[model samples]
Target: DHHLNPCYVCNSTGHNCRALPRMRPRIPDDVSPTEITGNGLSETEPPVLEEEMEEPIGVEDTDFVLYVSAVETERCRRGLTVAYASHCQQESALDRPVAGHANFCPGELSTKYRDLPSVLSTVKHEMLHALGFSVSLFAFYRDDNGEPLTERRPDTGNPPLDEELQIHKWSSRVVKNITRKNWMIRGGFMERTFHMIVTPRVVKEVRNHFNCSTLEGAELEDQGGDGTALTHWEKRVFENEAMTGTHTQNSVFSRISFAMM
Candidate 1:
């Protein structure tokens, strides 16, 4: 199962795949203000226009765009996999993701699976990853007011990881650590550690779901190595939820998943 995890492919390169060059607005050539204003015309007079200015080049009309493609592969033919996706490019200023790519396996596109809830859910799940619901993109997240969740490097604009193996980056407002103790039937107690998304909306939903007012935040998957860890909801805590690392027969797009988004 670890070998089949998709994040290995999604984050293969260590960075969001080579970022596309940023599009900068092209400024128009200089034009004299007086020449367009009819040579010292009075305020009461209407200004004569010499030419109409065209809209600036390279101005984007949309905030984000995702490019999807289907590719047939032997692996998909043999496995139960659906698709894989990743953010390909991101805006430099706020490190906001502006472009991504999703690759659906053509081999798995059968008529039987068409409009099926499981396949549709898988599509939505991969799209969410393409749209920044990823560990690689976590460092680039922004607050409601457009501030970076994690501090970024001035030169590279990427968040520095705390530990290469375990902790990547931490934003107290977005994610936090929690300790849990579970009593074993045979012996004493087993201690477990978890990272949680402590954002207000997510915390509210989590608390309401578990009926525990003191719950910190929603739990994130801490297993499955780099492929499944940190980027998804913990399967044990949120079984059958669409955002969990592994797909399930009865996965649902729960409110907690939406709130985390």
Candidate 2:
């Protein structure tokens, strides 16, 4: 479904895959590097890591992160979807011209939300999505040579959620190491699913606080429709988080989102 689409990964990085600058922005000193413990750590840790708990609101790294979704995203391929998170995952500063692409459903945005606050808010939401917040398409990020990017090692220091949504811990090796080269649902959902962001709190907030869904339990998304497999949070989680499948008045950008970029 992804072939020479309007990809943002290369645009944002300026085709840096051939030679990524050594002086990319460093992680801010205020944010601590992820700590390792005796937990079942491995080299397949997720690309994005935020706080131990909670999907913090409104954090972003604009350098390597950007937006583009004018293509075959999982949901509403040619619909009014706004944008998708897309970026390259080069193996190192000196790799071939490989580019990984991520896209969201296409949609005609409404004029009502075009004001500065609303526009910027929406951009914040999409930017975080590009950074891999609560997003599952990270499995497709590839190097310039069309090969899957390498995953970091020693999975460690993530907060825990229910079995269905274990954001902190990877459930399998495939999701951790495998790439979606030819297919989407590959390797027990480790690649097809987002194992970094958990929506338990958001789900609860939606179910209890915002009155979103009727179904109970920690099923992040409903049965499955319109490419809902691993691209979005349960529609009701956190009552319209920026990364949810649907957008609403309650949308709020997450802080944990910023760290992932």
Candidate 3:
């Protein structure tokens, strides 16, 4: 059986623990008002009826919750996917996720390979994706001061469209372009370009990791199409990092990943 525990209950730090705030669903503006009681009471009635008071909805006092489940899938058997995760709900006030879901494939959970380091790392990696590491959530990110990093529509509280009315999702504050050179077989040298996350903490950590003071930021994965591109670290640069697109033996949760968070 799968046993789950609240992180706040298991945390030893008590008040020092920085946790995600619980999100409350917003009520629709078009909701009709509650009907008054004893509306048709005669004027001759001796006693007047009091309107019943409605109790306010209470929200749980805890961090975000992640629901995990195991299932069988063809992708798992074909070695195409081991697990997948996504945020299911977001808090309107902060624009951050309050709940997420992760699905694990039973085929990849065989007794023989379940205990492997790579397998364990894959589980943690998927959990990270559920939390906030997603391209879809980038536009909702906020800065240290609780302000949105990307401009949003005041009415819908969502990212606004570009001049051409195209969906503009990525936050310019998070992603930037950097140019590099690649030696090609046919061409002597070619200018290769890709996007990178230039958040302050990410830039500091990556620059220190490579001991390059002039470096702009850490590179993001440009390959692997929609599933892998922009959402993960570049495989060639971060071969064994847990946030990379492909899992490798002895995968490590690097400090750079934490800095990105």
Candidate 4:
């Protein structure tokens, strides 16, 4: 079954099939901060308030809007895969992890897609998966006392070093760009499965090959010449102190996920 492992691309419908139309991207319009509570407006009241209300006003006019996805859906229909919409919802999904499959299925699409914003996000998420850029596991690092390091605020002196941070930083960017859409799947056994598969390799590489102890003393070589690599003590510390924590599962996946991020 290893050879039979199905990727997301297996579901391509051929020539006779019609493509799924892309949904619109949600947009906002100029609306007063005061929300309208009226179920219906009177014909008599509208004319007098027209001068006071915002221009382009009408009885049925809405301030809500839908934008970008129409363009993407068209591209999908034409069999063109676009990668990396910078404004995509991948970051948002990372902030709020969810159970992917349980909440999302083709059958539930009808109800979910009724909400324009959700529809666009949902489509973009699936497209990311189809392209193989979805995040399987995401985590940051912590200090010796189990406090999460602030990657954002580097101004707070120095930060703890862990191989996971390096791998996560490198892999996250590569994975994000690999897809034309954004990733939405979060915190599930699927995420854990992916972590289990790749993390051990990362751990092994950090443990055996990357030398942190000699990083500082290792002289840097000329750019054109074969440069000497710097000694990195953090790598050794990570292996000895970070990796040896008391956990039932000593696997890299367990360590990283359970790290005090």
lDDT of each: 0.71, 0.40, 0.71, 0.27
Name the best candidate (by TM-score): 3
Comparing 1 and 2 on TM-score, the stronger one: 1
**What are the models' TM-scores?**
0.68, 0.37, 0.70, 0.19
Tens digits of lDDT, candidate 1, 1-261:
111112212254345544223222232345445434434444644444443233324324777667888887654564455677888766667766667878888776655854587778878998888887887777677777888778776644567666545334757777888878883546778877789988777888999999999999999998766557888999988989899988867878888877766
Q: Candidate 2, TM-score vs. the true structure?
A: 0.37
Kindly give the number of clashing pairs for every candidate: 0, 32, 0, 10
* Higher-ranked by TM-score: 2 or 4: 2
TM-score, ranked from best to worst = 3, 1, 2, 4
TM-score between candidate 3 and the true structure = 0.70
User: Per-residue CA lDDT of candidate 3, range 80-174, in tens?
Assistant: 66788888767668877777888888766646655676677878998888888887777777788888888876655678644442334767688
Better of 2 and 3 by lDDT: 3
Q: lDDT per residue, candidate 4, 7-70, as tens digits?
A: 2221322113332322222222433324323532333333112111123222244321212232
Off by over 4 Å in 1: 1-60, 72-80, 108-110, 113-115, 161-168, 183-188
Q: Rank the candidates by lDDT, best first.
A: 3, 1, 2, 4
The worst-scoring run of ten residues by lDDT in candidate 2 lies at 1-10
